[model samples]
Target chain A: MKQGAVDAVIRGLKAAGVSVVCYLPDSLFKELYPALDADPDIRTIPVTNEGEGAAICGGVFLSGKRAALVMENSGLRASIEPLARMGLGAGIPVIMLMSYRGDLGENNWWAIPHGITMEPLLNAMRIPYRVVRKEDEIETAIHDAYEWAYAAYYHVAIALSGEIVR
Target chain B: MNRFDCMEVLSAQLKDELVILSLGGSVDEWYNAAPHMRKASLFQQQLGCVTPQAFGLAVGLPHRRIVSLDTDGGMLFNLGILATLGNEQPENLFVVVWDNECYQSIGGPPTHTAAQRVDIAAIARGSGVKEAHVATDLATFEEHCRKGLAAREPYIVVAKVTSTVRRDIRRKHSDGREDKYIFVRHVEETENIVIMGPSEHN
Candidate 1:
């Protein structure tokens, strides 16, 4: 499930024609970064923070390009400002790939509160999201997320779990 | 060096071509005091990204001057931008680091910026800015700034300013996002916005 989830996410991004990705080095998505970095088809911008990454994606979108940001759920908190202010204001779509940190028998106690609050926070921001519990749902989630992004002109996040942890 | 006086010189010299990326807090005084100065962007204290963002603007536009008006406190957040700027080698960038020895934007909190003892200009010299200068006050600052711009190099000018914040001056005038969009659009719509060159550097 480990490499499988990675492959599915990469395939989904390629299928959607995502050309650039913004990321802040996160342990959860370490495996995916190098692959995308080396791929000549895509441009990867390593940002200092999640909010900056999100804002850069907004910029990429305004320039008429497709973009996605990879981050752990903790990165979600830092992104709220840019997500709400610019992304929502300009009707830019963002595909957020998040690693579920503190959910379903997770050990890290500190990540628990944020993990619990993540979905609700997205709801509060009115940014649509989905949880992809299995590798099979990856493509559908990404495709639907892109559609939602275009229709709503807002951010759409997908959480990978069960299979991701493997 | 008089901060206001140096700003006046810079404004008179480079206002036509460059947009300074200002930081939040007390540095607003120099920017606000000199309305004659050229237009600038992203003045809010978003910390550390302004330089890179300016570099990004420089790359995308490739036809305008991109100046980052940074505070030491803010610059410390992501110094890596220096290496990246040098690596990318965008010729249009001018990073002006205002080191007043405190986080004057947020109630003058001490932000061990550059370790106080470290000569930030020397650090910039080592960081590949290619042309970095440290000016103690307005006169020297104005002089160095002119030379840096005149040399046609990616420059870093570290101004050692006095720790001063005008309570009346606003900390932030534009939301970071709005500035980004407007400036980005400004670069895009106009193919050639840089009106002046090193010849005009005061």
Candidate 2:
């Protein structure tokens, strides 16, 4: 039996000592929401929007706890304000795990804009990111994002694309 | 009563509880009212984010009480946070929205709360915040603050106040970034946990 993507993501989050997660569900990661909610060690908060999730993550950071914001790549746009003010302005870091919605070979025509604007927007914010395509690489990407994010006191993102999100 | 009077009453009822002030006016008010309270920090003008940030603090540090002095304009920026708050319902969080009904810091443009009669308390209740209340007077606002802060349930108080804000008060901290450091340090000391990672300063 193959290891599930959700399990892999959970393992990575645990390894990074992430106790809290603020998420806004998207179709790409709908299954992950239930798993995150059920996990005893992880506190999952369902936010109304990605901006709320980002701010919540910032608040968690202020409490001396590790929190991650998990959302769709399109949500990166929604969260830019909080991310910019909190991370860029105030030096509070928020680690994000986003699902790559409009990646290559995507079937939905509407999702293309999400992909088209994703990398550029992230770059404009000066947020370092990695698009992880392999299931085996999920945990490393998550762990790496946290390590550097905390060290630099800056926002970092790992987008699950390729087969992982597909 | 005046916004400062409400803040003074709120300032009088403080101990180790964490305070998160909204962008401009509330931050200045909190600082002037309680200058040495490092546990209280100013989150820069990220309207629509302050209440959710307080919600995060409440949920994350369940042992500590989190109070957010959010503003009407700030709440209107992202009213969706009320629904999230009502849904998550962290018991330790107490929110007080100072409803001056306008953008007081930015030259007094009327917000929906002023023009369209946007009842934030009603909206909060509709969104599932059972403990939401509106305080048009200082006595009611103080009562809500005094009791709401002590309650073990999630609470919200929409304090309708005047648009008058004092500009003479100076910031205790140099900038939001400095205040952020102070806030993190206070939590690290009081909570006996290390929050800041290996940065250049560390």
Candidate 3:
């Protein structure tokens, strides 16, 4: 993943009107996390678990503020409950930006199964998502997502799949 | 009136029009002691999380009222939920954490929460929960709870109740599944949602 792409996401989130950001610790999202933390307009919430983060985002969005969740792909499974029950059920729009850890050209076998299942599971939930392989696409995708989210009060996601971090 | 009776009053007043997530400790004890909760089919979930669960429920069930029955001990575990709640301010949600001066779940051990005299309601205000207040006694609690429910913004009411609670009440659901499972099932069944967590849990 290009540094520019991560920066683009930060800019897009700010531009898209997201005021609260929730995330768990992840080495993969090193660059993006700090930038988000430093933003004065955004209140960054660090949670012990990804599930808690999801739940937090649910609350954040329900309060009528745009919110985002940053985490590794593995964290996805942990957040299943809040995502569905709160994110989708209440029409609270949450933008989930993930750093996909395993995929082609990746050596981490443990992360492979989850990475493989990621898209399919998201599809099963009927969540429309995008794979951000390049930096330029981040902004427009985010803008479109925000539009969809605010207009429909639904959740939107962007999966950073493949070997972008290394 | 007893703490349990206070909760019953809130439940009876709210009826099935709202959803609540009550935490452990005496709040759980009191909620369980109430005969109506056992008999009535309200959208109430008695699980591990009190405030956090309410946060999630409020997100999806936005149009309906959602409340969290929290305890000082449980709230201490993740007070950041308040910061998030304050920042998020879901108008349909209300947070009620009973600060009974002790960890009513364990052996009524004195909680450090009171040491700070945290004034949780003040904390809620500082954090940005639109409506926040602290109440002691049943009447005060009932009034605040009712006002919170009626408010147009997110509300937080911290009620100080007795630490002496029956220890024999069931602390958790009869089901053996951990808190993770309950949330995961909700995520799986819902659409347009993305979840993240539990790389591993003991």
Candidate 4:
């Protein structure tokens, strides 16, 4: 992730009233983690897995504060059940900021399944998401996700792909 | 000891302290034990989330006391949270697990702790929690909750309970959405903040 994009994520999350972040590191978004950890206003937590991160983010919402779960798209698969339980069953929203792992970028072979299953899984969960490719749209994508999620009492996803993560 | 006995002791110490109960038999018992207390319990909605969500609540409200009425089965399902909780070690968090040794609801099969296959308190300590203990009797359990609540430390107490059900607990369906709203509103009211429907929210 570019420094500009990293800064945009931090600012956007703060602007969207997300004061805490629970993340499981993935190589694609490695740089963003440190910046998030150093931010003074945001309470950053390093989770053992994406499932733990999703539930932690839900807890943050329950505590009268907004939070975001940052991770690779593969973590989405790990978090699906809790996400479903929270979003679909309880109307608790988890604003997810994930790195698009298996986009059109011809990279690692392990990345293929991530791209293939990402959208279909999102659709299956009825979670609204946008795959962001440009740097300029990163902030708005995050800001809008928090907005839409809180209003509808639903979860939203924003995957940074293309130039933003590459 | 039974779950009701353990919860009654803990409920006696609560005053404006927030609680998040694990899914299953523990929910109705806690509700029955302390009907007016501020609490949230996911009824058959999500499994293995009570502790993690309570951890989030503790982190979110660093100044307030947060309790988790977690279960042995739920704890086994997501043991990784122990590492995270120990690592963070939020001071306002207090965790109490009802270790009944089996899945009391789903035909009563033995869980990891049934024959001592897993020790949750030890795992929590190994994971990084500064204080963790096992209470087999009501007196030990009460002492632990009293001291833990007074100190407001990150403490985990695994209370051993029998598979016996409490006939007095009123069984009913608590929809996840309904619990969420009521719980959130209680937090807002106690904390003096507006939590519901906030875009540029605090």
Candidate 5:
């Protein structure tokens, strides 16, 4: 992740009233973690797994605040059950910022499945998301995701790709 | 001892503390014990989320006390949450696990706690939760609850309870969405923060 993209994402989160961020670090979002931790207004919780992050974000929402879960797309697979219980079972919204690991330019053989399953899984869970490839779209996509998630009481995902993740 | 007896003792001592209860017998028992407490949030779905959700609430609202009523089966499903809670170490959080040793809601199938001798409080302690203990009787359970409720450090009290369900005590099925709204409303009002907006009139 580029410094510019990190800054933009932070700005967007702050604008969306995201005071708590529950995340599991992935290679793709490594840069964003330090930036998130350094931000005085935001509290970053490094979770053991994505499912734990999802549940924590749900709790943050219940506490009358906004929270975001940041992780790799594969982490979404790990979080499916909790995500469903939160969004489908209980009308609780958890805004996610995920990295597109196995998209078009990927070379690692292990990552192909990540890209292959990300979109279909998101769709299956009925979570609306935006694949943000351009630098300019990063902030706006995150801002829009939080807005929609809170207003609709459902999840929204922002998948980073293209130059941003590279 | 029975879980409801434990719940009754805990409920009598609670004031302004937020409680999160896992699905199944605990929910019904809690509702029966403290129906008037609006600070309680009952889970109708998400079997393993009771503690993690409470952890999040504890983190978000550091000043308020968070009490989580979890079960042995729920704990077994998400044992990783114990590590997370231990690592985070939220001083205001207290977890009470009703170890009935079976999946009581799903027709009394034996859980790992029953067959394999899983010590949940020991697991919690090993996972980094400093104040963890197990109680077998009503007096010991009540004492632990009282200490946990008043303590500054986070506490995990696993009460060894029986598998018997009080058939006479029942609570209506709480809709998940309505439960979320009510819980959020309670948080907003107590914390003096705006969380939800009115639904648009179409």
Candidate 6:
């Protein structure tokens, strides 16, 4: 991931009033972790898995603060249960910032399914999402996700692609 | 002792601490034990998320104590939360796993804790929870609960209990959405922070 892109995402999270971030690290968004940790305004919790991260974000929401879950697209599959229980079932919103793997121009064969299953899963869960293929859309999409999630009281996903994760 | 007995003793030790109960029997029993504590009690319908949710609340509200009333079946579903809770090491968090060793709510199906004899406290310690204890009786359970609530470090207390159903276990006070609003409002009032706001369109 580009340093500039990471900075932009962080700025957007801060702008969205995200006081805490729970993430499961992936190679695609490796750079974002340290930057998130370094930020004084946001408390970052590196979780064991995406489901745990999702639940933590739900917990943050319950405590009257906004939180984002950062993970790889594959983690979306791992996090469906918590997302459904907390976000869909209970009406608590968890904004997710995921890196797009197995996307266009991808080299890894194992990563292909992640891209294939990401959208369908989000749709099945009725989670509105935006896939950011351009660097400029990164910040706005994240900000929009938070705004929409708060209003809708549901989970939202922002998939980072193109120059941002390249 | 049964789950209700454990909750009955434990509820007396609680103050204004936030509570997250696992799905099924824990929710009903806790509600019966402490109806007035509903504002602080988040009845988690999601199995396996009790501790994780409490961990998030603990991190978000660092100044307040967060208690997770969990069960063996639910804990088995997301055992990794033990490692996460251990790693995060929130000082104000305490987890109480009601180990009846079975999926008591749905049916009397034996879980790993009962059939295979899984020691949850050992797993907690191995997962990095420094203070983990298993209590087989009410006295030990209450003692551990009191210590865990008062301690500055995170603690996991597994109370060995019987799968005895209470006859007067009533329905929860509110549905999920209502519970959320009420709980959030309670947090706002107690913590003096504005969480939910009126609709802008209204």
lDDT of each: 0.67, 0.86, 0.65, 0.86, 0.88, 0.88
Whose TM-score is higher: candidate 5's or candidate 6's?
6
Q: Which stretches of candidate 6 lie above 4 Å from their native place?
A: none
User: Best candidate per lDDT, number?
Assistant: 6
> How much is B14 displaced in model 2, in angstroms?
0.5
**Candidate 5 error regions (>4 Å):** B199-202
The per-prediction tally of clashing pairs is 4, 0, 13, 0, 0, 0
Q: Considering DockQ, where higher is better, how would the candidates rank from best to worst?
A: 2, 6, 4, 5, 3, 1
lDDT of 6 by residue, B1-202 (tens): 8889889898998889999988877777899898668889988798888899999999889999999998898889999999887887889998999998888888888989886558999999999998999999999999999899988888999988988878787877677888888888899999999877765684
**Native-referenced DockQ of model 1:** 0.09
Candidate 4 residue-wise lDDT, A27-114, digit = tens? 9899999999999999899999998899999889878898999999999999998899888888878989999998997489999999
TM-score of the B chain in each candidate versus the native B chain: 0.78, 0.93, 0.73, 0.92, 0.94, 0.95
The TM-score leader among the candidates is 6
Q: In candidate 6, how many clashes are counted?
A: 0
Q: Give the per-residue lDDT of model 2 (tens digit) for B108-187.
A: 88889997567999999999899999998888888999888988777999998988888788755567688788788888
Alpha-carbon error at B8 in model 2, in Å?
0.8
Candidate 3, position A99, lDDT: 80
Residues B34-120, model 3: lDDT tens digits: 535432212223332457656755665566676677767667756677776776677887777777767665566787675865667
* Candidate 1 vs 2: which has more lDDT: 2
For A125-153, candidate 2 gives per-residue lDDT tens digits of 99999999899888989989988998889
Give Cα distance to truth, residue B104, candidate 5, Å: 0.6
Q: After superposition, how far is residue A43 of candidate 4 from its true place, in Å?
A: 1.3
How do all the candidates rank in terms of lDDT, highest first? 6, 5, 2, 4, 1, 3
